[model samples]
Target: MIYAGLDVGSRTIKLVIFDTVVKESLITETGANPLRRCREILAGRKLRRLVVTGYGRHLVASTQGGKVVSEIRAFAVGARYLLPDCQGVIDIGGQDCKVVRLSMEGDVLKFEMNDRCAAGTGKFLEVMAHTLEADIGAIGDLALTASRKITINSLCTVFAESEVVSLIGRGEETAAIALALHEAIATRVATMARRVGIKGKAVFAGGASLNRCLVRLLGEKLGIELTVPDSPQLVGALGAALLAKHEDGQ
Candidate 1:
């Protein structure tokens, strides 16, 4: 069967087309408008089922005649499918951070999320990248080469930008400051994960999970090796696809 999943995230929309019988999947990302982009992507596809998940799940759910699943559930389902031993998931997106505790069967046992601020989200890194005049993709490599550890006093993106400026004025290298920013963000996210009671064999997902610096810092703070999906950003969509597959069996 051909199943389609749409993840309508705050900053971007993701689509996944899966051939369940063959266990193959195709993923794509577009702007935040999931309804429009989903229709555009599904135009020529012959999908037998569809499911939606993520921040804007309800918005696309109605249009696609599909059910809305929580991002935590979807992420856990997708992560565990790819890494069956995964017992925890940490997802840091554009606007929030989520930590989900999962059972051996891939069910969500407990979860915690921080949607109240931009401090620990991908936006934090984006703002910092702009302030440092550094490429977001290169930030990780630059951070890895830092000679010293600088403290970032503020977790607020605006305040952090100001702190970065002050550090630059004090002759601190951009690489060091950037590394500190990533470490600060990782600390916040690690705290959230701890609140949910993280276990070993954790999986990190979402757009920010692709940031090597943040992932490395997260691993260090959590003191656990994290499994990253082949396409970290597509976990939600993959989970949605898995949901569609289940519904078809019913």
Candidate 2:
């Protein structure tokens, strides 16, 4: 029987099905009607066990029926499974960022999360890309071409946008501005990782993990190698699926 895990997040929904190995996995934008998106994804599938996680986990659990797991637990478990020797996990999602420190046994030791604002998150990157009038999907790659980027001090979304505009008016290179924005995020995330006392290699998960610029900058700033799964956004869902399989087996 296939066990399923669903991570219904603010910006995207991830689904994972496991039968000895991961047999099915998908990631889609949450869109305006996230519940509908979730329902559509789960349709016509027979799942023996289901576990829900992410920002909208409870919403999915109450309406769709599944075991609920916290984002912290899901990331820890998922990172541990993907990188068995991993000591921590960092997830930079659409609206928030999470840092998890793990024990050798894959238990959560300490974790930090920034969900109070859009600053230093995927939302920030999206907005910055829009402000630069650059393709959101290509912004990361474009940033990689820049020789250097200017300093951005504000973490607030509105303030940062204003800063970008001022930089543009001053004839700052578009690529440089984009690179600076990603640098800001890297600085913030690296600071969080250090504050959490993370050691050894860590798994980088969530949609933002797709941004190569952010990944490289973060890894450099932290002075540690970051391991990314083939499908980083599905890590939470994979964790939930593993949990579902464990529960069903029991």
Candidate 3:
């Protein structure tokens, strides 16, 4: 029997199929219609069990017929699978940032999120990068070489963009602006980690985990080296698929 996990995120949909061994993994843009995109992604797949997760989990479960798991649960499981000694998990996705502390047994102890806001998420960085006329990923490289961190007063996306414009007008270096923006998010996420009591190396997952600037900034802020999976963005889906594989009577 085959097991599958589907993560329907705000910006992308990730799928993982497995049973003892991973058979396939894929990611595609969420686009305008997630349901439609999901259907397109699963056109000819067969599975004995399916697990759905992420913000759009309920929407997909109702229409697509699958069990649902919270992002927190799935992430913990995935992190542990990749790094058995994982003490924490941080996911910086398109719409929100999440931090979770875990037990050695892979159970979720505590978690925190940004209240359904785009304050320090991938979407927030995308917007800031556009306003700065810089490549989102490339700016991280620039930020690394910058010496000073420009203070980003507001975490709000709109106001931050305005702030970026004013900085540009003032002729502030783009790298400084990038560092400031990255600092804002890294600082906020680190605070959440502290609240959850995550003091050791944590698993950094989700799309934003790909941002080198965020990785370095977050690691420095937390004062701990972070661990990232080979396929960080698929961690949630991978966990869900593994869970489905373990479900009885599959």
Candidate 4:
């Protein structure tokens, strides 16, 4: 039997199909309108069960009879399934960030989330990069070449952009400013993770994990080694699919 999971996030949508008997998986992404895209992706495919998760999950119609899972719970399950030794998860999406601490069995121990602001999320980096006239995709590599840390004092995205512009006016190297941005984001996320008390092996998920500079800075700030899954952004969908199979069993 095949189980399907859909994670409809703010910036992107992800889908994962898991085969029960063979334990194989297929993962894909659809930029927006997740519900419609999911339907189109699953056309003619026989799925034994389906689950939905993420911030935009409620937008998915209940008429489809798919089970709805919280993004936090789904991430916990996905992290556990992929990295059985994982004890915590740090997921930084486009607009929000979450730090989840789990027991050895993958049960939630504690968690903290920063959804009210974009300071610690991917959007902040995107905006900063745009302000610096730098490519978002190249920020990581550019930051690595910096010789000094340029401080970004503002946690507010608007104020931070203005700060970056001011730094540019001062003839600061973009690399230094980029390093500062990543460090700022790392500091914000690390502070949240400390509230829940990071434990054991940690797994970093979501699109931001793809940023090497952010990952290194975050790990350094948290004082813990972090692991990234093959496809960090798909972890939620994978968990949803796993939940679909578990639900089918009951």
Candidate 5:
């Protein structure tokens, strides 16, 4: 029997299927109708149990039957499963950022979240990448090659976008500007993590965690050796899947 977990995130719809014989996950754009996209993804799947989590958890739960878990709890469970010694989780999603402190048993002890603005989330990077006329996937690698570290003073997405554009017009290197954006986000997220008192063995999970430059900068700013799951973006879904299995007594 397969246990499925659906994570309806702001920018992506992630699905994970777990069972005694196999473990798999899939990612798709959330698009205009997330519930419809999710239905299409699970069209023919046979699930013994289902669990939903993330920003759109309630929406998915209302249209589908599943246990609901907070993103904080889901990340903690997913972190522990991937990094057995994990004590903290930093998840930077499309529109929000979360710093979760976890217990040895995978319970969420404490967490700090930034949901009011897009300054330190994936959307921030997306906008920066667009301003620089660069691909989001390549921005991280490009940032790593910067010879000088530039500072992005603005904390607002709109101002930051304008700043990036101005810098480009002033002949600033794209690489340096990209790194600055990552650094800015890392600093903001690190501050939030410190508020919860970061512990040892921290993990970075979420779509933004896929940015190598951001992950490195975040580790440096937090002064912690951060680890990323093979599929960081799927961590929440994986956690939900694990929850479904337990809920089903499978």
Candidate 6:
């Protein structure tokens, strides 16, 4: 059967097409407007099942024929599919960060989210990248090369931008500042994880998890190793696809 999953996140839309009989999946990403993008992607295909998840899941569901699942549940299902033993999941998206503790059966036990601010999110890193005139893809490598460490105290994106400018004027190296930015984001995520009681065998998913520097910083702050799926950004979509199959069998 051809199963499809769509995750309508704030900054991007992720789509996954899975062939259950063949046990294969094709993943794709598009800018916002998930409903339109999803229709565009599945236009010519015959979808036996469809499921939606993420920030704009409701809109996607309204436009498309599918059940909308919570982002936390979708992420946990995706993480568990990737790492069957994972007990916790940390997903940092463009505008929010979530820490979800999952049960052995892949159900959410507890969850915490930071959605009130852009701090500790992918948007924060994007702003920092713009401040340093650095490419978002290159920031991680640059941060890894930093010889000195700098501390960024402001968790608010606006104040942090001002702080970044001041540090630049003070002759602080860009690499150090980049590392500091990752550290700051990691600290906020770590604080959120603590509230939900992060456990070992933790899995990290989402587009932000693609940054190795941020992953390393998070590992240090959480004081434990974190497992990342092969395609971190597709986890939510993957979970949605899996759920679609499960519902069909019900």
TM-scores for all predictions: 0.94, 0.97, 0.96, 0.94, 0.96, 0.94
Superior by lDDT: candidate 2 or candidate 4: 2
Evaluated against the true structure, the overall lDDT of model 4 is 0.87
Q: Can you tell me which runs of candidate 6 are displaced by over 4 Å? A: 21-32
lDDT of 4 by residue, 1-250 (tens): 8898888788877888887532545445556566777677667878899899988677773756688999899999999888998999999999899999999888999999888999999999999989988899889989999999879999899999989999999999989999999988998999999999986689999999999999899888888879999889889989999999999983
* C-alpha lDDT of residue 171 in model 1: 83
Worst 10 residues of 3 by lDDT: 241-250
Which candidate leads in TM-score? 2
CA lDDT of each candidate? 0.85, 0.91, 0.88, 0.87, 0.89, 0.86
Residue 126, candidate 4: Cα error in Å is: 0.5
Residue 200 in candidate 5, Cα distance off native in Å: 0.8
Q: What are the per-residue Cα lDDT tens digits for candidate 1 across 1-250?
A: 6898788888877778777433544445547556788677667778788888988788777886778888888888888878998899999888888999988887888999989889899888988999999998788788988999888988998899999999989989888998999999999999988888887899899888888888899999999879888788888888888888888883
Per-residue lDDT of model 6, residues 18-70, tens digit only: 76532445455556556677777767878788899988888778877889988
Clashes of each: 0, 0, 0, 0, 0, 0
> What value of lDDT does candidate 3 attain over all alpha carbons?
0.88
Better of 5 and 6 by TM-score: 5
Report the number of backbone clashes for model 3.
0
Q: Please give the RMSD to the true structure for each candidate, in Å.
A: 1.7, 1.2, 1.3, 1.8, 1.3, 1.7
lDDT of 3 by residue, 1-250 (tens): 7899999998899999997788899999999899999888877888788899998999888877889999888888888889888889999998888999988777888999874778878889899889988887787887887778779999888898899999999999888998999898888888888998886768999988888989988898888769988899999999889888777454
Model 5 clash pairs are none
Q: Among all windows of ten consecutive residues in candidate 1, which has the lowest summed lDDT? A: 20-29
